[model samples]
Target: MGLFYSLRGFFRSPGAPPRDAGIQSGQPGGYSSESAAEVTFDSAMQISPVWAAVKLISETIGSMPFNIYEVGPEGRKIATAHPLHRVLTRKPNQYQTDVEFWESMALNLAISGNAYAIIQRLGNEIVGLLPVSSSQVETTLLNDGTVVHAYTTGANVKVYGPQSMWHVKLFGNGIVGLSPLSYARNSIGIAIAADNRVSRVYSNGAKPSGVLTIDKTLTEAQRAQVRASFAGLEAGNDDRLFVLEAGMQYQQISMTPQDIQLLDSRRFQIEDIGRFFGVPSILLNQTFGQSSLGSNVYEILAAFYKLNLRPYLEKFEASVPRWLMEADEAGRYECEFDFDAALLRADLQTRMQANREAINSGQLTPNEARIDEGRPALPGGDKLLIQGAMIPIENAGLKPVQEVPSGTQESEPR
Candidate 1:
């Protein structure tokens, strides 16, 4: 009987050769009658280790669906196979049989920490086989003290960083896709064609060829203050607050009550409100006492009494001694009958009430009611006192605030 076997089965082993019909002789079991009939099978069936190794590798590689080829020196095609060859009736074209596919796959696997290198050839040129090793991986240190490892083959590259799924990708043309490799860490992978001309390096999927920098000039205190400012706390009146002096003539800026509170709280007394307002404490006190309609005692009482001026008068009377006190021609006491004496007495009572209300309401707002505006306006609706001189608020129907000529005089009421 004739025996038939597939090509794959035939290559599985080195077996006995077929017996020729011409060599047959009349024997009990129809044995071959040739002079070489006594030939030992061991000598004929011997196999080389190299061939066995190749066969084993081919068999194992054939199990995979990827196209496989044995590349040799001078770009010789020693062998070629595809996983689908058994199922498909036709074979794949030469393009599928080239070394480019294997080279690309090797690059991808190398970047992924799989096989380090791949060996293949194009036409007759033997591309060197890549050795599997991790020494070629690149490392980088981040500003936050993180170390990263990056892997690259000629065609593909990958990076493993602190973050999850961070990587970059490129093609023969140029950059294509970039993203994280895995969600567990900020790793990234990139791919490119073997013949691609462009070269790029990516970190976390972003090209990083230029200088990287971070400003670290701020002191710890300043940094803390900046952080606090975002949290709604006063960082102190530095340039961080208003840009210009408070009293300088410029565009007016509106402020909410809360804004005012924060401004006052954080303002650097010497640098901010005090210097910019240009009002020294002594000058401020004199201006308030002279131009303000109410007494300092009344100001204190108003805070605690909630806008009532009566308590100030009551406190003033109780604090003064019952004695004849001399007054100057201007009705100002020359004997120092009271300085802030009245204010001091009312302050205790006022502060106590203020504290109580503040505690209950959880509100602590400073008193900023007294502010100097340089000049005061008269009640009649058209006069301003500039250096004790009465000036018209408007000229005719449109009273101009500018100074009139020295020789010019106001028109008499007609």
Candidate 2:
């Protein structure tokens, strides 16, 4: 089977606009401009079909905050706040100092092989630097030929490296620990021991033998990749398992009616939010949840969409109508208007024409006007332009607004 078959289930024809496509292009009853702008794919699914699935889900459902649950090695049930949930539930008292400290520590370990470090920001003053080291950073090639760098603190057990940086934390007595090695080996068991400080590692029914610790000096890129991977993991888990149990008490605080009400009141419902906003929602929903104090799935989702998603969609939506109008007037929509292929093609054609004209006008030599496959090739070139001639459209009378000359002003210059 091909990679597409491995990822997506099967290939099907792209569907036409639904008779009652709720909101099309921002208008009611008809497809909203936003909805109309979306393109449905008809091609075979790729190896990672989740990307397309996520895009479709975001476009269809907007963005709602969700909870995530996962079973680590030994069936240890673990639950935490979704990152989206955290944003919605952000409070004035919430601070990033602790998180930042561990993050810095993770980065340092990635680059310098140093694990111990301190993060200081005293109203713009340097404060302290702690001792840390990377006991090991070894690259292991997988069966797929992917080289994975395993960074370990001590013993054969691997400490979370660039992949699991977020879980690294410095608890009481300044002790830091890595997330369990479940990602690498599922049956490899890990148990938080009675001390509440150390994690006991067990593999294949053997007694819990090893301990886990954190690596402090991870690089910014490593930190980002780790964070993104964690987010993806959380999203996968949310869709797959509901690990959290509602009505469960925490620290003697009952999950009561009032608490549920509070959570509902603060949580943001994802119904029609766009895809960009959905990224944060997926992140938060996977990271934080209702159980997260001062932060719930709703609040995190609400804040992210409000703070991030809305503005992005607005800008994107605003640009579409003009492009659509242009395509309509030109009677030549791109292979996929929803994908903005026409606009890309037009832009490419314009640049290529300019370059050709420049060469013709003695502004550049033939050598200077080179054509290379990878060198910013013009979109919808002669071949693609011919291929794009078959776009089907119901109307072609809508004229797009043309750019006016710089001197042609509607009002006096400020």
Candidate 3:
């Protein structure tokens, strides 16, 4: 808490973690989940599906082409020369690269439904963005209608007004983003409980593989001794021989469908969690059967971006001007995550074909397309060209060049 006292209205990590999550994460307190297991962010990450889903979304979005664009009478173009441009692209602060900083912010957004960073400024000019976690911040709408965030850790609190912080929020009541983890805790608790059941089953070793019974009744002391011995054997004495007293007979327990059902339930829980996060099972590499979306994995991955990712991208783009730029620069500069880069990155064939169509439609000059593809421009490639075959609807059958009438071919052969 006191670590950030040097920076004005700034903090690294503030507030204690959520109840159940704190215990697992080795923090102070904890709460019981719906499934009676502790479902905190730390514990949830231990579950494979949760880890994969959060990582996939965070890394993919964080690494995509996030750019600053300047708007003018002509159109929008990359604002490469802007001061904030270098700050966001190269380094957001002294300790992190652009990718690392955004990835952390994206991770916070994925789990907590909000991401925040302190806007460091020297006088009126902005300097750096110091990232912080959702747990550290609390937001409130003041009576005068301003949103203020208070960062609390233990008893220390640091408050920040709109001008000093950048906030990216997910869908919620417009005051604060709704935390996905809080809402999904029940589902996560079930997964955690299922995992704990397996561990308990093995660790307790009370589930009998075979029972030894005697025709004569055994005394309480004898039964206790028998149970203790068997527990020892079950733990790590698999090769040990069990000597039965009083002509006991050994009976083996047959496998039951309940065991199979337990495994199945665990697998289903993975998909259940995926649905909450808007991540398809295919992305989790758990394609137990055919995907409902389709059998083509590529197509499903494409849909993942459009359906699961596009909203987040748009939210970030829309919030950046308000969050990062100065009020006076609002109309002049904006930010966007290159939607094409997210969807077309690996599909080079599709990218080339799309670029070709763009060029032929006169939407992009040949030189422009070349530059986009990281190739040098040709001398005449700066000009936009359209297909000559395109003709007026009414002149469909007429010769493009009105050929000289048969006799009108100016002295034909001569």
Each prediction's whole-model lDDT (CA)? 0.28, 0.30, 0.75
Which digits, one per residue and each the tens of the lDDT, describe model 2 over residues 1-414? 224322322343334312221111110112112221112121111111223323433342222222223334554222343221122122201343333433434333322222332222234322332323333443333454333334455566543322222212211111222211111111111111111111111111212222222345668996575555433222232333222223321132233324345333323322112122234434434333432222544554455545544433333233222321233422321111121121122345766786667554545444444452125434433221111222222223345568879877777688
TM-score preference between candidates 2 and 3, better one: 3
Pairs in clash, predicted candidate 3: 14-136, 20-31, 21-40
lDDT score of residue 364 within candidate 2 = 48
- Which residue ranges in model 3 land beyond 4 Å of their true spot? 1-33, 153-155, 202-213, 217-225, 232-234, 237-260, 388-414
Candidate 2, residue 258: CA error in Å?
Answer: 36
The numbered model that scores best in TM-score is: 3
TM-score of each: 0.13, 0.16, 0.79
Which residue ranges in model 1 land beyond 4 Å of their true spot?
1-63, 68-124, 131-414
Residue 292 Cα positional deviation in candidate 1, in Å, after optimal superposition: 80
- lDDT tens digits, residue span 115-225, model 3: 888989878767788888888887767656678888787899999988887888887656667677876787888889888877765664535466667788779998897
lDDT of 1 at 24: 15
Clashes of each: 21, 51, 3
